[model samples]
Target: MLNGLKVGDKAPIFEGLDQNGKKISLKDYKGKKVVLYFYPKDNTPGCTAEACNLRDNNTLLAEKGYQVVGVSIDSVESHKKFETKFELPFPLIADIDKKIVEQYGVWGEKKFMGRTFDGTHRTTFLIDEKGIIAHIIDKPKTKDHYNQIIETWEK
Candidate 1:
Protein backbone atom coordinates (compact mmCIF):
# COMPACT_ATOMS: atom_id res chain seq x y z
CA MET A 1 0.00 0.00 0.00
CA LEU A 2 1.27 3.47 -0.85
CA ASN A 3 -1.00 5.25 1.61
CA GLY A 4 -0.96 5.61 5.36
CA LEU A 5 -4.47 7.09 5.49
CA LYS A 6 -7.35 4.74 6.14
CA VAL A 7 -11.13 4.90 5.84
CA GLY A 8 -12.77 6.68 8.77
CA ASP A 9 -9.66 8.66 9.58
CA LYS A 10 -9.95 12.44 9.57
CA ALA A 11 -8.95 13.79 6.19
CA PRO A 12 -6.09 16.19 6.37
CA ILE A 13 -6.92 19.83 5.74
CA PHE A 14 -4.94 21.62 3.03
CA GLU A 15 -4.88 24.89 1.13
CA GLY A 16 -3.41 25.73 -2.28
CA LEU A 17 -3.97 27.85 -5.33
CA ASP A 18 -6.33 26.49 -7.88
CA GLN A 19 -6.06 26.89 -11.65
CA ASN A 20 -7.57 30.35 -11.45
CA GLY A 21 -5.13 31.29 -8.73
CA LYS A 22 -7.95 31.22 -6.23
CA LYS A 23 -7.21 29.88 -2.78
CA ILE A 24 -8.91 26.54 -2.27
CA SER A 25 -8.95 24.51 0.89
CA LEU A 26 -10.47 21.28 2.09
CA LYS A 27 -12.43 23.24 4.62
CA ASP A 28 -14.22 25.08 1.84
CA TYR A 29 -16.44 22.07 1.41
CA LYS A 30 -17.04 21.47 5.07
CA GLY A 31 -20.68 20.51 4.88
CA LYS A 32 -20.50 18.64 1.58
CA LYS A 33 -18.97 15.33 0.58
CA VAL A 34 -15.64 15.78 -1.14
CA VAL A 35 -14.05 13.88 -3.96
CA LEU A 36 -10.42 14.78 -3.44
CA TYR A 37 -8.44 13.28 -6.30
CA PHE A 38 -4.70 13.39 -6.67
CA TYR A 39 -3.10 12.85 -10.02
CA PRO A 40 0.51 12.47 -11.16
CA LYS A 41 0.49 15.21 -13.79
CA ASP A 42 -1.82 17.64 -15.50
CA ASN A 43 -1.77 16.76 -19.20
CA THR A 44 -0.81 13.12 -19.17
CA PRO A 45 -3.08 10.56 -20.83
CA GLY A 46 -4.46 8.93 -17.72
CA CYS A 47 -4.74 12.19 -15.88
CA THR A 48 -6.64 13.86 -18.69
CA ALA A 49 -9.04 10.97 -18.95
CA GLU A 50 -9.72 10.99 -15.26
CA ALA A 51 -10.28 14.73 -15.12
CA CYS A 52 -12.55 14.70 -18.14
CA ASN A 53 -14.58 11.85 -16.76
CA LEU A 54 -15.18 13.84 -13.61
CA ARG A 55 -15.99 16.93 -15.63
CA ASP A 56 -18.57 15.10 -17.68
CA ASN A 57 -20.32 13.88 -14.62
CA ASN A 58 -19.96 16.99 -12.53
CA THR A 59 -23.61 17.91 -12.55
CA LEU A 60 -24.60 14.46 -11.37
CA LEU A 61 -21.98 14.59 -8.69
CA ALA A 62 -23.18 17.95 -7.47
CA GLU A 63 -26.72 16.70 -7.40
CA LYS A 64 -25.58 14.02 -5.03
CA GLY A 65 -24.09 16.63 -2.67
CA TYR A 66 -20.54 15.94 -3.72
CA GLN A 67 -17.85 18.47 -4.50
CA VAL A 68 -14.82 17.58 -6.60
CA VAL A 69 -11.31 18.88 -6.26
CA GLY A 70 -8.07 17.85 -7.93
CA VAL A 71 -4.54 18.14 -6.68
CA SER A 72 -1.21 17.77 -8.47
CA ILE A 73 2.39 18.86 -8.04
CA ASP A 74 2.13 20.93 -11.20
CA SER A 75 2.28 24.71 -11.08
CA VAL A 76 -0.70 27.04 -11.23
CA GLU A 77 -0.02 28.00 -14.84
CA SER A 78 0.17 24.39 -15.92
CA HIS A 79 -3.09 23.65 -14.18
CA LYS A 80 -4.76 26.67 -15.78
CA LYS A 81 -3.89 25.47 -19.27
CA PHE A 82 -5.02 21.94 -18.54
CA GLU A 83 -8.27 23.14 -17.03
CA THR A 84 -8.97 25.46 -19.94
CA LYS A 85 -8.13 22.85 -22.52
CA PHE A 86 -10.47 20.30 -20.99
CA GLU A 87 -13.20 22.69 -19.81
CA LEU A 88 -12.95 21.13 -16.38
CA PRO A 89 -15.57 22.55 -14.04
CA PHE A 90 -13.81 21.79 -10.78
CA PRO A 91 -10.86 23.38 -9.08
CA LEU A 92 -7.45 21.85 -9.73
CA ILE A 93 -5.02 22.72 -6.96
CA ALA A 94 -1.41 23.45 -7.83
CA ASP A 95 0.52 21.69 -5.12
CA ILE A 96 3.92 22.93 -6.21
CA ASP A 97 5.41 22.80 -2.72
CA LYS A 98 4.21 19.20 -2.21
CA LYS A 99 2.80 19.91 1.22
CA ILE A 100 -0.71 18.68 0.42
CA VAL A 101 0.51 15.44 -1.13
CA GLU A 102 2.79 14.76 1.80
CA GLN A 103 0.00 15.46 4.25
CA TYR A 104 -2.30 13.09 2.36
CA GLY A 105 0.48 10.48 2.17
CA VAL A 106 0.24 10.21 -1.64
CA TRP A 107 3.74 11.35 -2.44
CA GLY A 108 6.14 8.41 -2.67
CA GLU A 109 8.33 6.26 -4.89
CA LYS A 110 6.70 4.92 -8.03
CA LYS A 111 8.14 2.53 -10.62
CA PHE A 112 7.46 2.87 -14.31
CA MET A 113 9.17 0.79 -17.02
CA GLY A 114 11.52 -0.59 -14.36
CA ARG A 115 12.66 2.87 -13.38
CA THR A 116 12.05 4.12 -9.86
CA PHE A 117 11.18 7.74 -9.19
CA ASP A 118 9.41 9.96 -6.72
CA GLY A 119 6.02 11.20 -7.81
CA THR A 120 2.41 11.65 -6.84
CA HIS A 121 0.47 8.42 -6.81
CA ARG A 122 -2.92 8.61 -8.50
CA THR A 123 -5.43 8.25 -5.68
CA THR A 124 -8.91 9.42 -4.85
CA PHE A 125 -10.11 10.04 -1.33
CA LEU A 126 -13.82 10.24 -0.64
CA ILE A 127 -14.18 12.48 2.35
CA ASP A 128 -17.52 12.66 4.03
CA GLU A 129 -19.23 15.85 5.17
CA LYS A 130 -17.55 15.60 8.53
CA GLY A 131 -14.08 15.56 6.93
CA ILE A 132 -13.55 11.88 7.62
CA ILE A 133 -12.30 9.64 4.87
CA ALA A 134 -15.13 7.44 3.73
CA HIS A 135 -13.30 5.52 1.04
CA ILE A 136 -9.95 5.42 -0.70
CA ILE A 137 -9.59 4.55 -4.37
CA ASP A 138 -5.96 3.55 -4.65
CA LYS A 139 -6.06 2.54 -8.32
CA PRO A 140 -8.84 4.52 -9.89
CA LYS A 141 -9.92 3.70 -13.43
CA THR A 142 -9.31 6.93 -15.30
CA LYS A 143 -11.89 6.59 -18.04
CA ASP A 144 -14.63 5.63 -15.63
CA HIS A 145 -13.66 7.43 -12.49
CA TYR A 146 -17.00 9.13 -11.94
CA ASN A 147 -18.87 5.85 -11.96
CA GLN A 148 -16.29 4.39 -9.66
CA ILE A 149 -16.87 7.20 -7.18
CA ILE A 150 -20.64 6.93 -7.37
CA GLU A 151 -20.64 3.17 -6.96
CA THR A 152 -18.27 3.35 -4.05
CA TRP A 153 -20.39 5.95 -2.34
CA GLU A 154 -23.58 4.03 -3.01
CA LYS A 155 -22.13 0.88 -1.53
Candidate 2:
Protein backbone atom coordinates (compact mmCIF):
# COMPACT_ATOMS: atom_id res chain seq x y z
CA MET A 1 0.00 0.00 0.00
CA LEU A 2 1.13 3.52 -0.65
CA ASN A 3 2.14 5.65 2.27
CA GLY A 4 -0.21 8.36 3.39
CA LEU A 5 0.20 11.66 1.62
CA LYS A 6 1.08 14.83 3.51
CA VAL A 7 0.69 18.55 3.23
CA GLY A 8 2.68 20.23 0.42
CA ASP A 9 2.56 17.08 -1.67
CA LYS A 10 1.09 17.35 -5.13
CA ALA A 11 -2.54 16.38 -5.03
CA PRO A 12 -3.17 13.22 -6.98
CA ILE A 13 -5.29 13.64 -10.08
CA PHE A 14 -8.26 11.39 -10.69
CA GLU A 15 -11.44 11.16 -12.75
CA GLY A 16 -14.45 9.06 -11.93
CA LEU A 17 -18.20 8.93 -12.34
CA ASP A 18 -20.38 10.79 -9.89
CA GLN A 19 -23.80 9.90 -8.56
CA ASN A 20 -25.42 11.19 -11.75
CA GLY A 21 -22.99 9.34 -14.03
CA LYS A 22 -21.20 12.54 -14.90
CA LYS A 23 -17.41 12.46 -14.88
CA ILE A 24 -15.62 14.43 -12.15
CA SER A 25 -11.92 15.15 -12.22
CA LEU A 26 -9.69 16.93 -9.78
CA LYS A 27 -8.28 18.88 -12.68
CA ASP A 28 -11.74 20.25 -13.41
CA TYR A 29 -11.53 22.19 -10.16
CA LYS A 30 -8.21 23.74 -11.04
CA GLY A 31 -7.69 27.30 -9.85
CA LYS A 32 -9.99 26.64 -6.90
CA LYS A 33 -9.55 25.07 -3.50
CA VAL A 34 -11.00 21.57 -3.36
CA VAL A 35 -12.02 19.50 -0.41
CA LEU A 36 -11.34 15.94 -1.50
CA TYR A 37 -12.71 13.60 1.13
CA PHE A 38 -12.65 9.82 1.16
CA TYR A 39 -15.03 7.65 3.08
CA PRO A 40 -15.39 3.89 3.51
CA LYS A 41 -18.96 3.53 2.23
CA ASP A 42 -22.09 5.42 1.38
CA ASN A 43 -25.01 5.81 3.79
CA THR A 44 -23.04 4.69 6.82
CA PRO A 45 -23.46 6.72 10.01
CA GLY A 46 -20.12 8.48 10.12
CA CYS A 47 -20.03 8.96 6.39
CA THR A 48 -23.56 10.32 6.44
CA ALA A 49 -22.71 12.78 9.20
CA GLU A 50 -19.63 14.05 7.39
CA ALA A 51 -21.41 14.41 4.08
CA CYS A 52 -24.41 16.06 5.70
CA ASN A 53 -22.24 18.51 7.52
CA LEU A 54 -20.61 19.51 4.30
CA ARG A 55 -23.95 19.68 2.55
CA ASP A 56 -25.45 21.82 5.28
CA ASN A 57 -22.60 24.28 4.92
CA ASN A 58 -22.35 24.20 1.16
CA THR A 59 -23.06 27.89 0.74
CA LEU A 60 -20.51 28.88 3.33
CA LEU A 61 -17.92 26.60 1.82
CA ALA A 62 -18.57 28.03 -1.62
CA GLU A 63 -18.34 31.53 -0.27
CA LYS A 64 -14.96 30.56 1.18
CA GLY A 65 -13.89 29.36 -2.28
CA TYR A 66 -14.03 25.68 -1.63
CA GLN A 67 -15.44 22.93 -3.81
CA VAL A 68 -16.25 19.66 -2.09
CA VAL A 69 -16.09 16.16 -3.52
CA GLY A 70 -16.56 12.87 -1.76
CA VAL A 71 -15.20 9.47 -2.79
CA SER A 72 -16.05 5.94 -1.83
CA ILE A 73 -15.86 2.42 -3.18
CA ASP A 74 -19.63 2.38 -3.50
CA SER A 75 -21.35 2.09 -6.86
CA VAL A 76 -22.79 5.01 -8.73
CA GLU A 77 -26.30 3.88 -7.91
CA SER A 78 -25.48 3.77 -4.22
CA HIS A 79 -23.96 7.21 -4.40
CA LYS A 80 -27.06 8.50 -6.13
CA LYS A 81 -29.30 7.10 -3.43
CA PHE A 82 -27.18 8.56 -0.67
CA GLU A 83 -27.01 11.94 -2.34
CA THR A 84 -30.74 11.97 -2.94
CA LYS A 85 -31.48 10.87 0.58
CA PHE A 86 -29.34 13.61 2.09
CA GLU A 87 -29.77 16.27 -0.58
CA LEU A 88 -26.02 16.62 -0.82
CA PRO A 89 -25.03 19.48 -3.06
CA PHE A 90 -21.60 18.20 -4.07
CA PRO A 91 -20.61 15.33 -6.28
CA LEU A 92 -19.85 12.01 -4.64
CA ILE A 93 -17.43 10.10 -6.82
CA ALA A 94 -18.13 6.42 -7.34
CA ASP A 95 -14.71 4.90 -6.99
CA ILE A 96 -15.77 1.39 -7.84
CA ASP A 97 -12.35 0.34 -9.06
CA LYS A 98 -10.63 1.80 -5.98
CA LYS A 99 -8.16 3.55 -8.24
CA ILE A 100 -9.02 7.01 -7.00
CA VAL A 101 -8.60 6.05 -3.35
CA GLU A 102 -5.30 4.38 -4.07
CA GLN A 103 -4.15 7.43 -6.01
CA TYR A 104 -4.85 9.69 -3.07
CA GLY A 105 -3.23 7.09 -0.75
CA VAL A 106 -6.35 6.65 1.37
CA TRP A 107 -6.79 2.92 0.68
CA GLY A 108 -5.31 0.81 3.42
CA GLU A 109 -5.81 -1.65 6.20
CA LYS A 110 -8.30 -0.72 8.87
CA LYS A 111 -9.26 -2.11 12.26
CA PHE A 112 -12.74 -2.15 13.70
CA MET A 113 -14.36 -4.35 16.32
CA GLY A 114 -11.20 -6.43 16.64
CA ARG A 115 -11.28 -7.33 12.96
CA THR A 116 -8.84 -6.06 10.39
CA PHE A 117 -9.59 -5.57 6.74
CA ASP A 118 -8.49 -3.68 3.72
CA GLY A 119 -10.70 -0.66 3.12
CA THR A 120 -10.75 3.01 2.43
CA HIS A 121 -9.64 5.07 5.41
CA ARG A 122 -11.83 8.02 6.27
CA THR A 123 -9.55 10.89 5.31
CA THR A 124 -9.76 14.36 3.87
CA PHE A 125 -7.35 16.28 1.70
CA LEU A 126 -7.45 20.00 1.26
CA ILE A 127 -6.14 20.78 -2.16
CA ASP A 128 -5.12 24.34 -2.79
CA GLU A 129 -5.86 26.24 -5.97
CA LYS A 130 -2.55 25.15 -7.41
CA GLY A 131 -3.23 21.43 -6.89
CA ILE A 132 -0.98 21.05 -3.89
CA ILE A 133 -2.13 19.53 -0.64
CA ALA A 134 -2.64 22.28 1.91
CA HIS A 135 -3.61 19.99 4.76
CA ILE A 136 -4.65 16.41 5.45
CA ILE A 137 -7.16 15.37 8.06
CA ASP A 138 -6.55 11.69 8.72
CA LYS A 139 -8.91 11.24 11.64
CA PRO A 140 -11.79 13.47 10.75
CA LYS A 141 -14.48 14.56 13.17
CA THR A 142 -17.58 13.28 11.45
CA LYS A 143 -20.06 15.83 12.80
CA ASP A 144 -17.72 18.79 12.47
CA HIS A 145 -15.83 17.86 9.33
CA TYR A 146 -16.55 21.10 7.50
CA ASN A 147 -15.13 23.13 10.35
CA GLN A 148 -11.94 21.11 10.24
CA ILE A 149 -11.48 21.99 6.60
CA ILE A 150 -12.33 25.62 7.11
CA GLU A 151 -10.08 26.01 10.12
CA THR A 152 -7.19 24.33 8.37
CA TRP A 153 -7.56 26.53 5.30
CA GLU A 154 -8.02 29.66 7.33
CA LYS A 155 -4.90 28.84 9.31
Candidate 3:
Protein backbone atom coordinates (compact mmCIF):
# COMPACT_ATOMS: atom_id res chain seq x y z
CA MET A 1 0.00 0.00 0.00
CA LEU A 2 1.30 3.40 -0.92
CA ASN A 3 1.55 5.39 2.29
CA GLY A 4 1.54 7.89 -0.55
CA LEU A 5 1.47 11.11 1.45
CA LYS A 6 1.76 12.20 5.05
CA VAL A 7 1.66 15.28 7.17
CA GLY A 8 4.62 17.60 6.48
CA ASP A 9 4.92 16.29 2.91
CA LYS A 10 4.28 18.53 -0.05
CA ALA A 11 0.91 17.86 -1.65
CA PRO A 12 0.98 16.31 -5.10
CA ILE A 13 -0.17 18.51 -7.97
CA PHE A 14 -3.03 17.32 -10.14
CA GLU A 15 -5.21 18.80 -12.88
CA GLY A 16 -8.73 17.56 -13.53
CA LEU A 17 -12.15 18.66 -14.72
CA ASP A 18 -14.74 19.89 -12.26
CA GLN A 19 -18.47 19.20 -12.39
CA ASN A 20 -19.10 21.91 -14.97
CA GLY A 21 -16.12 20.84 -17.08
CA LYS A 22 -13.97 23.61 -15.73
CA LYS A 23 -10.29 22.78 -15.40
CA ILE A 24 -9.04 22.69 -11.80
CA SER A 25 -5.48 22.47 -10.64
CA LEU A 26 -4.12 22.20 -7.13
CA LYS A 27 -1.42 24.63 -8.15
CA ASP A 28 -4.00 27.35 -8.56
CA TYR A 29 -4.51 27.44 -4.78
CA LYS A 30 -0.83 28.09 -4.10
CA GLY A 31 -1.23 30.83 -1.56
CA LYS A 32 -4.35 29.51 0.15
CA LYS A 33 -5.04 26.57 2.41
CA VAL A 34 -7.03 23.76 0.81
CA VAL A 35 -9.43 21.27 2.31
CA LEU A 36 -9.22 18.46 -0.24
CA TYR A 37 -11.59 15.66 0.69
CA PHE A 38 -12.26 12.35 -1.06
CA TYR A 39 -15.39 10.31 -0.61
CA PRO A 40 -16.54 6.90 -1.87
CA LYS A 41 -19.28 7.79 -4.38
CA ASP A 42 -21.98 10.23 -5.30
CA ASN A 43 -25.43 10.31 -3.69
CA THR A 44 -24.79 7.36 -1.40
CA PRO A 45 -26.07 7.81 2.19
CA GLY A 46 -22.83 8.35 4.06
CA CYS A 47 -21.24 10.13 1.14
CA THR A 48 -24.18 12.47 0.83
CA ALA A 49 -24.10 13.36 4.50
CA GLU A 50 -20.36 13.95 4.44
CA ALA A 51 -20.64 16.09 1.32
CA CYS A 52 -23.47 18.16 2.74
CA ASN A 53 -21.46 18.79 5.87
CA LEU A 54 -18.65 20.20 3.82
CA ARG A 55 -21.05 22.06 1.58
CA ASP A 56 -22.72 23.68 4.56
CA ASN A 57 -19.38 24.78 5.90
CA ASN A 58 -18.04 25.95 2.55
CA THR A 59 -18.51 29.57 3.42
CA LEU A 60 -16.85 29.16 6.81
CA LEU A 61 -13.86 27.52 5.23
CA ALA A 62 -13.75 30.27 2.65
CA GLU A 63 -13.97 32.91 5.34
CA LYS A 64 -10.97 31.26 6.95
CA GLY A 65 -9.19 31.64 3.58
CA TYR A 66 -9.34 27.97 2.83
CA GLN A 67 -10.71 26.48 -0.36
CA VAL A 68 -12.88 23.39 0.03
CA VAL A 69 -13.08 20.83 -2.75
CA GLY A 70 -14.16 17.23 -3.00
CA VAL A 71 -13.01 14.43 -5.30
CA SER A 72 -14.54 11.15 -6.31
CA ILE A 73 -14.55 8.60 -9.10
CA ASP A 74 -18.03 9.69 -10.16
CA SER A 75 -18.47 11.06 -13.66
CA VAL A 76 -19.29 14.65 -14.48
CA GLU A 77 -22.97 13.86 -14.89
CA SER A 78 -23.19 12.19 -11.49
CA HIS A 79 -21.26 15.09 -9.95
CA LYS A 80 -23.65 17.55 -11.56
CA LYS A 81 -26.63 15.70 -10.12
CA PHE A 82 -25.09 15.49 -6.65
CA GLU A 83 -24.12 19.14 -6.65
CA THR A 84 -27.50 20.28 -7.86
CA LYS A 85 -29.31 18.09 -5.38
CA PHE A 86 -27.42 19.33 -2.39
CA GLU A 87 -26.68 22.81 -3.73
CA LEU A 88 -23.00 22.28 -3.01
CA PRO A 89 -21.20 25.55 -3.42
CA PHE A 90 -17.79 24.02 -3.89
CA PRO A 91 -16.55 22.20 -6.94
CA LEU A 92 -16.54 18.44 -7.06
CA ILE A 93 -13.90 17.05 -9.36
CA ALA A 94 -14.79 14.08 -11.52
CA ASP A 95 -12.07 11.49 -11.17
CA ILE A 96 -13.72 8.65 -13.04
CA ASP A 97 -10.40 6.86 -13.50
CA LYS A 98 -9.49 7.34 -9.81
CA LYS A 99 -6.12 8.69 -10.95
CA ILE A 100 -6.16 11.57 -8.48
CA VAL A 101 -7.56 9.41 -5.66
CA GLU A 102 -4.98 6.75 -6.40
CA GLN A 103 -2.22 9.33 -6.45
CA TYR A 104 -3.37 10.59 -3.08
CA GLY A 105 -3.47 6.99 -1.79
CA VAL A 106 -7.18 7.16 -0.97
CA TRP A 107 -8.12 4.55 -3.58
CA GLY A 108 -7.51 0.95 -2.67
CA GLU A 109 -8.94 -2.18 -1.17
CA LYS A 110 -12.24 -1.58 0.63
CA LYS A 111 -14.82 -3.86 2.15
CA PHE A 112 -18.38 -3.67 0.88
CA MET A 113 -20.94 -6.25 2.03
CA GLY A 114 -17.88 -8.03 3.41
CA ARG A 115 -16.45 -8.31 -0.09
CA THR A 116 -13.29 -6.55 -1.11
CA PHE A 117 -12.94 -4.19 -4.08
CA ASP A 118 -10.80 -1.30 -5.13
CA GLY A 119 -12.43 1.98 -4.14
CA THR A 120 -11.89 5.17 -2.25
CA HIS A 121 -11.34 5.14 1.50
CA ARG A 122 -13.17 8.21 2.72
CA THR A 123 -10.36 10.52 3.80
CA THR A 124 -9.62 14.19 4.12
CA PHE A 125 -6.39 16.09 3.52
CA LEU A 126 -5.64 19.58 4.70
CA ILE A 127 -3.07 21.18 2.46
CA ASP A 128 -1.39 24.34 3.59
CA GLU A 129 -0.60 27.36 1.46
CA LYS A 130 2.84 26.06 0.57
CA GLY A 131 1.28 22.83 -0.72
CA ILE A 132 2.42 20.77 2.24
CA ILE A 133 -0.15 18.56 3.87
CA ALA A 134 -0.95 19.69 7.39
CA HIS A 135 -3.25 16.90 8.44
CA ILE A 136 -4.66 13.62 7.15
CA ILE A 137 -8.02 12.46 8.47
CA ASP A 138 -8.48 8.82 7.66
CA LYS A 139 -11.92 7.33 8.32
CA PRO A 140 -13.47 10.69 8.98
CA LYS A 141 -16.85 10.83 10.70
CA THR A 142 -19.50 12.47 8.56
CA LYS A 143 -20.94 14.57 11.38
CA ASP A 144 -17.68 15.68 12.94
CA HIS A 145 -15.76 16.43 9.76
CA TYR A 146 -16.47 20.12 9.41
CA ASN A 147 -15.88 20.86 13.06
CA GLN A 148 -12.63 18.94 12.85
CA ILE A 149 -11.60 20.97 9.83
CA ILE A 150 -12.37 24.20 11.61
CA GLU A 151 -10.43 23.03 14.66
CA THR A 152 -7.53 22.16 12.42
CA TRP A 153 -7.44 25.66 11.00
CA GLU A 154 -7.53 27.17 14.46
CA LYS A 155 -4.42 25.30 15.46
TM-scores of the models, in the order given: 0.98, 0.97, 0.95
Per-residue lDDT for 1-155 in model 3, tens only? 25568899989898888999998999989999999999989999999999888888888878889898899999999999999999999889999887899889988888889899988999999999999999988868896788988776677
Off by over 4 Å in 2: none
Root mean square deviation (Cα) for candidate 2:
1.2
Candidate rank order under lDDT: 1, 2, 3
Whole-model lDDT per candidate: 0.95, 0.92, 0.89
Candidate 3 local Cα displacement, residue 69, angstroms: 0.8
Per-residue CA lDDT of model 1 for 80-148, tens digit only, reads 999999999999999999999999999999999999999999999999999999999999999999999
Better of 1 and 2 by lDDT: 1
Model 3 misplacement above 4 A = none
Worst 10 residues of 1 by lDDT: 1-10
Better TM-score candidate (2, 3): 2
Give the lowest summed-lDDT range of ten residues in model 2. 1-10
lDDT (Cα) of model 2: 0.92
Residue pair clashes in candidate 3: none
> Which tens-of-lDDT digit does each residue in 4-120 have in candidate 2?
678898998899999999999998999999999999999889999999999999999999999999999999999999999999999999999999998888888888999999999
